[model samples]
Target: MNFTTQRIEDIVVFTLNETKLDANNSGLVKAEFTLLMKLESVKKLIIDLTDVESCDSTGLSALLVANRLVHANDGDVCLVTSSEKVLSLIRITQLNKVLSVFDTLTDALQELKSK
Candidate 1:
């Protein structure tokens, strides 16, 4: 998966460039995100999935695990989901209630800053 990371002041913004986030690419996502979360000063995270095509259970699990880690550090993960398929998966898994999802990356960043 292709990705880029930037800090929105204290919050980090991770934008996915890939069209898919499945088992084949979920591991990379987890590793990259885990590394970012290790920063002591980092707090909130905004995951931009505007270009994401689909997400599988493994991808969802990776995101959930990352969210948990962020929460443990008094931070949170806000997802910018533009993919219907991904949103459907989250809905089916009842993860939408557990994770904060936004329609745009800007909205996600705003929510993160508010927190």
Candidate 2:
């Protein structure tokens, strides 16, 4: 559940500071991330997952909720991660098609900023 929040222009970036993203903290992630999206100034989200080396189904579910929340608000959400394991899970679950994945925070920030 430990993370950092920062605003760069209209994008609200949430940097997950945990290594394992699982059921134990997914609910918290869902809650905090949704709260951030409710801010009127937040038009997009970049979830920096550089510290998150692993993820589970519940974690992906939390991510899905974040995605839906952003879209519901007419905003966008992108996942920024260099972890192959996390990317593999997203691919295996076919979430890579649904979620925007970036290899680095810089890439995600740049792309989301342009949108």
Candidate 3:
């Protein structure tokens, strides 16, 4: 898996260490998220996409699904380091307003904590 997850306080921090977030890596990302959500008190999530190079609708859908899942659990999702291309796609798709995006991990974490 090109993704990894660790806990920091009450948040589940998902770090993407891959160049692509296309279909090939979406499953891995989804599975790791499933595993992380199983843990208790994980009411906040930070997705670090600093290394992600590309994303399709499928990958973006996965993120929305994750966000929905988190919200269902009374939690929220924060996006970190969204590349310019990804950010553009997000804006065009109106997903930028849907997801909580941050330019840095610290900002993401602080946003999560504030919620």
Candidate 4:
């Protein structure tokens, strides 16, 4: 799992640097999300998947795990991706209704900050 994490105020921006987010690395991503959600100050998270061109069911499941953990902590989690495949999957799975999706990190940050 190639990724980078940065804190912008109270929000944690986690950028997945991999081209594919699949079963091979989704579990690591999920674990990272779980750990981040446990922190007292991390109330908002922006998962930047701009570099991720492809995603599998496990990848989507990892995202769901992040959403669940964040909401359980009374926090928010959003995803940023420019990949059409990823966007299509979110729509097909109806995850667009459950998770906030954005085209850019700036857009995601603004929305999360407003909340």
Candidate number of the best lDDT: 4
Global Cα RMSD, each model:
1.1, 1.1, 1.3, 1.0
Off by over 4 Å in 1: none
| Tens digits of per-residue lDDT for model 2, 1-115 | 6899988887888999999899999999999976776655456988888999999999999999988888888888899988999999999999988878999888998998889
- Top model by TM-score, which number? 4
| Candidate 3 structure quality by residue, lDDT tens digits, 41-66 | 56788889988878888788778878
User: Once model 1 is optimally superposed onto the true structure by TM-score, how far is the C-alpha of residue 5 displaced, in angstroms?
Assistant: 0.2
lDDT of 4 by residue, 26-84 (tens): 99999998877765556798999999999999999999998888887788999999999
lDDT (CA) per prediction: 0.85, 0.88, 0.82, 0.92
Alpha-carbon shift of residue 56 in model 4 (angstroms): 0.7
CA lDDT of 75 in candidate 2?
84
What TM-score, computed on C-alpha atoms, does each candidate reach?
Answer: 0.93, 0.94, 0.91, 0.95
Runs in model 2 deviating more than 4 A are none
Q: For model 2, what is the error of residue 99's alpha carbon versus the real structure, in angstroms, after optimal superposition?
A: 1.4
Name the candidate, 2 or 3, with the larger TM-score value. Answer: 2
Clashes of 1: 1
Task: Supply candidate 3's per-residue lDDT for 14.
Answer: 87
Q: Answer with 1 or 3, whichever has the higher TM-score.
A: 1
